[model samples]
Target: MTTIRMVGFDADDTLWRSEDYFAAAQSTFESIVGAYVGDDARTTERLYAIEKANLAVFGYGVKGMALSMVEAAIEITESRISSSDLQRIVQMAKEMLRHPVDLLPGVREAVEQVAADYPVVLVTKGDLFHQEAKVRDSGLSHLFRRIEIVSEKDVPTYRRLLEEFAIPPEGFVMVGNSLRSDIAPVLELGGWGVHVPYHLTWEHERQADIPADAARRLRSLTHADELPGALRAIAAG
Candidate 1:
């Protein structure tokens, strides 16, 4: 195995607080709409369905999520949802956009340590403006050599990233929370992938279990600070 010379980080849950906001927003949305239907479960399921359906049109972001909430509310109530409640859903989206960027535990120390030794890149996917805002506000912006806010995370995207950075896959390492978006692609490209499990993964980012052989190319850490040691072990192997 080649020594990894470049490290890539995933921005959302991997670096800072993200999904929790969505989860919170969902709760708020349900409370606002729950009065009409009185069934939080149905509304929740409907919201997820609307989000999935709108992904192609809205892509991924808080704005799209707001739209989905409105659509779900209208659908659940048969368009009987009040205009004021609709406005509340819009307000929820605004709140999410203005939400603070809270970095996960040890993100700063680990990122700084890796930046001192190798080039670090932030490879993240989502609405361009929101993702950029999170990175800019996260206070870890200066630690990365470059930032790539992509629409998708797949094999070709990683290949292009490797080429753009002028690094071979064998010499690159990706640390992220989602196996589907962050880990699997880099592993398929023959790079080292370090999985750091997150508590609340977005449904769309979930995938089947990785093959045994591929899973062996990676290590799982419970926290961000453990990343430096994991990378060192990979290099040592």
Candidate 2:
């Protein structure tokens, strides 16, 4: 019989504070862009549109968001935005990139506890340099058997990772904050999921649709402390 021999974790939000910073940067962005455009709602919408459209090109992380912000600012203001404000936008991204990694409460202990019984892998997607720095800074790197910094989290990616591990999809569990990225795809591939919802999520992540049957294989936990119990429950079933 197949069992949950390996567990995967998503880095942002799930393990640490991420989107909160992004939200703040967006507010900063809105303020910078707001000077030229009076409509806050329109400004935010336009920026998001640009960011989403640029995902394939810029990919994900502070640099991508920074570039998209610069583009959005220019387009929203019709090139009326001054160089000073543009510099401020660049400063915002700089602050984010340099920001320290603050892991969530109980996450370190939770990962340690889970790793005691099963092998764990970090399945995160973002800028390679940023993710590498975060993993090195996390202090929890030694707990993971493998660290996957992916471009995107989808069926194909997960399948490849599982193949590399030589484990079947049904014998794995993915723990994360985004249902779209962490939970749904793994569940679709017959893996179990433990969802630890963060207080803040990106607009793009919030829009992902999980399949109707995903809930049956998913365990939603509010805090990191509850992860081990959820995994035990899955293991028992």
Winning model by lDDT? 2
Which residue ranges in model 2 land beyond 4 Å of their true spot? none
lDDT values, one for every candidate: 0.89, 0.91
Q: What digit string (tens of lDDT, one per residue) describes model 2 on residues 1-237?
A: 338889999999998899999999998898878878886549878888999999999999999999999999899889999999999999989899988999999999999999998999999999999999999998999999999999999999999999999999889999999988998889988898888889988888876666777778888998999998898888888
The global Cα lDDT (0 to 1) of model 2 is: 0.91
lDDT value, residue 10 of candidate 2: 97
Backbone clashes, each candidate: 0, 0
Candidate 1 residue-pair clash tally: 0
The collision pairs in model 2 are: none
**How close is each model in CA RMSD to the real structure?**
1.4, 1.2
Q: What lDDT tens digits, residue by residue, belong to model 1 across residues 49-127?
A: 9999998898788988988888898988888889999999999899889998999989999999989988999999888
Instruction: Give residue 76's error in model 2 in angstroms.
Output: 0.5
